[model samples]
Target: MSGPAAALSASPAGTGPDQVRGPVITGWSAVSPYGIGRDAFVQGVSSGRATVSVLDTERWPGPDELACLVPDFDVREVLGKKGTRSMDRVSGLAVTAVRELIAESEGAGLPAGGEEVALVLGTTTGSAQSMMDITRDTLIHEKPFYIDPSHIPNALMNCAAGQCAIWYGLKGPNTTVAGGRASGLLALNYARRLLTAGRAHTILCGAAEEYSPARSWLERHTRHPDENATVLGEGCAVLRLQPPGTHPHPLAELLCITTAITHPHHITTTLAHTIKRALHQTRLNPHDIWAVSPSTPPGTTADHERHALDLIFTDHTPHHIPAPGPIGDTAAATATFQITTLLSHHQQHPQPPNRIALITAIDRDGVLATALLRLL
Candidate 1:
């Protein structure tokens, strides 16, 4: 897309910005099939090589399947032995990613006290393996008390977010949003609202999914028979967001977040309107967008997303990037990966400061979300 690049001027409403300022993304970290850290994620996606590979069926006991898995990651390395013993795979990924973000923000002196920071993570069907194990134990043994007590906490949908707070000692508002593929965008919106309400000085926000035996089996059994359904993938990306003007050197400015629920009959129209709303909220025109990342994986969702994009930017074809093909379907982490892709592109190409990019996602549950970001 080509147009006169505009700089960010006014802060979003309800955010209580002393000056016209937007929320800034100061630091971030990731753990993905590429490996640990954001550098690996950037290099892996930039390389344009598919990170997905055939999963071991013997171990997982699922039909033929492929997944993008974090390679050779051991939670013990980040949390030590005792800390990781009771942690599930999802919690491990969340803790490890947050730890990386904190290490990256070292000299910046981030909020160290428990109440100074908030944790908002997005997930879908959290800790499926742990839940299944305990369920099986209880059902097979014919006793409610037969399930392992240590696994009880892992059965909760908010386990990953809750464990993150415990591990990092964050006492601020802790939350977990279950929005399927739209979870990342939902978490971002929630964090923005918390900042707007002045609930916390800083927010550690992101989404994570785990590639486990149970998850793979569940996907194989429940996935639609569409030939182009997304492949299961696992990863996490945690970003540190501060209220606008709080960061001296921010990677990007978050302009706006828009989301809506639509049915199949009105998906295209709804998505188009949602995208337009984001543009209107940020006072940006279609041409001002440097690029866009669509979070639709494949099949009907991809078709709907394409139809909406065609309608929104008819003549001007922005550098639209389809995320799932390159990284597989990360579910809840889809939007986060899209944002990371745009950030990586800005870093490598060094766009004129303030050039904007759009990230849009449609969850499996029909929730459409759009977020506008400006490189800074």
Candidate 2:
């Protein structure tokens, strides 16, 4: 075993309380364009293979012809036949990712389900296709009220989170946040607060997005006319978060997570400030950072993010792990994939103990976020 497989095989067996100071990430799983499990994602990223594929125009009629979709992912096939008659792509992705995370946790001899567990998911919108389809039916049918009752749930933004809770028997806190590209960090921050307030014993924090003609059309119309259109993509990533010492085998310790809203004109300064605040809160200097995973989509926003990072790390250069471009623009799941990239990089390339990794995210809608993690 060599490369990423060898690194993954060398994961720490356990850690002590004194070794980790904040909430620890016990495990994580992702359904990416690369494939379905953590290993697939790690290998796809490590190998740098292309994930973009031409879309079937009949199934996905839109301006964009290519997308980074989960290969051969069928809702009914991936999930099952029962209770999936109306399951949309987004919900299926979320449910599958969460299910994988639960299985990983249980395999590691860790508790995963019960009343003590909570779920927090982030998304741009539920399923644009489902919503548009229902609306179209209502308007086209002779009777205005004619619509599929089963598809109603898929249109709601909280449907994915709700489904995870119901399916996994998590009775604690269930929340859905909408923050565009910064959603993953926002979800992480919300999960940490829940743990601090004693709202739940553990939290499944992540984000999900789906690729569809409706979303593609929405992107085409919303994007700046001058900016180059990005290749839309979709996926989901979920992490099992618990307070320090709750689990001995941690992937990383969450030092701090911070977010802010500012005008687009002040994005660079605001993001720099957010990063500085996270560093201060964690009592870490820029020089302590060993690597960075940034979720800055292409165009003006990417330049702004680069400027912000340059402003903060003027003294030294930390190794940069570029965003998962091979996976295309994951939207809400951008930050989650960014975090996962850092973890995978650490595993493949061993670093000194207590070395920190930084993750920064910026959304066109004035949302900026920063998170610091200590690799274990």
Candidate 3:
């Protein structure tokens, strides 16, 4: 996540009139490997302690691998056993994170019911374990529709957001973005659009990933063999976003979000362009950015991202923070963590008002996203 930078091309041409304002993040919640709450996450990352540990070899047999997995997280304890009996790990994480977010913002001008709020979540892949089980049942079982009825709901990529809506009563609109590592930014941008368009007054936007034996196996085969590649991690984080002027004291104001899709080989250039476009759209100079949170995956992708950053901030050296180093690569959850980490850093350091931060993420599919935020 932290590395040398690069510059993007010329500023994005102005789109002229009728541009909508960005959304403001009023509240946020995180469930990470560090612990069950945002405070645990901030303390762990700020203290600079390593959170990565080896998964149980017997249960996750494979090469010696490291990961940042949530410790002793049981959904039954939080959501109770009845409904959770069918909830998969990812869905449970999403539900818990959303609950925490709404709880924390009880009287902070949030929507009163499900019809007033929308949910948009991101993911790399949906519930790998449940998908595997469903596939296995389809292949091995002798009868049609032999898969467990309990597993069906969890198999979809949109299950987390759908389940969150069900559990929290969020009924305005629900969406799922499969943007891989860039999922968080994609979801944020979508939520912002919803707010800007007056489609919803408030929205829950974030990302989640689960560390399971099935996911580990997929990574072992698909991920490159570079030592710098990050260990896999799992967690869910959600931000409660509202239109500007709606919340009296927002944590931060989201200024702009930009994304670009390209071929996989063009990740570096596309990412640089996306960041440049976001800054251009926000009308901010690179020097105006006080800090940068980059979602760097392992291997050549990391190198490409570092190079892109080096190019972007050639004049001033912004604080380069790597979101994945402490928590490992959390797939779709990486960018949400990055945004939260930026907020957390400001909370501890108390930066001057109106300072800006930039967050960027790139997925394996060559989806590049950049979000510009201004702290108040």
Best by TM-score: 2
TM-score of each: 0.92, 0.94, 0.91
- Root-mean-square deviation of Cα positions for candidate 3 versus the true structure, in angstroms: 6.3
lDDT of 1 at 167: 80
Show where candidate 1 strays beyond 4 Å. Answer: 1-20, 227-229
lDDT of all predictions: 0.80, 0.85, 0.81
Per-residue lDDT over 305-356 for candidate 3, one digit per residue giving the tens place of the 0 to 100 score:
8888988888889987668477778888999999988888888888766777
Better model by lDDT: candidate 2 vs candidate 3: 2
lDDT of 2 by residue, 279-324 (tens): 8776677888888888877678888999999999999999898899
Candidates in descending TM-score order: 2, 1, 3
lDDT order, best first, reads 2, 3, 1
Model 3: how far residue 315 lies from native, Å: 1.9
**Residue lDDT tens for model 1, 250-306:** 888788899999885687899999999988876777887878898865567678888
In Å, residue 231's CA in model 2 sits off its true spot by: 0.8
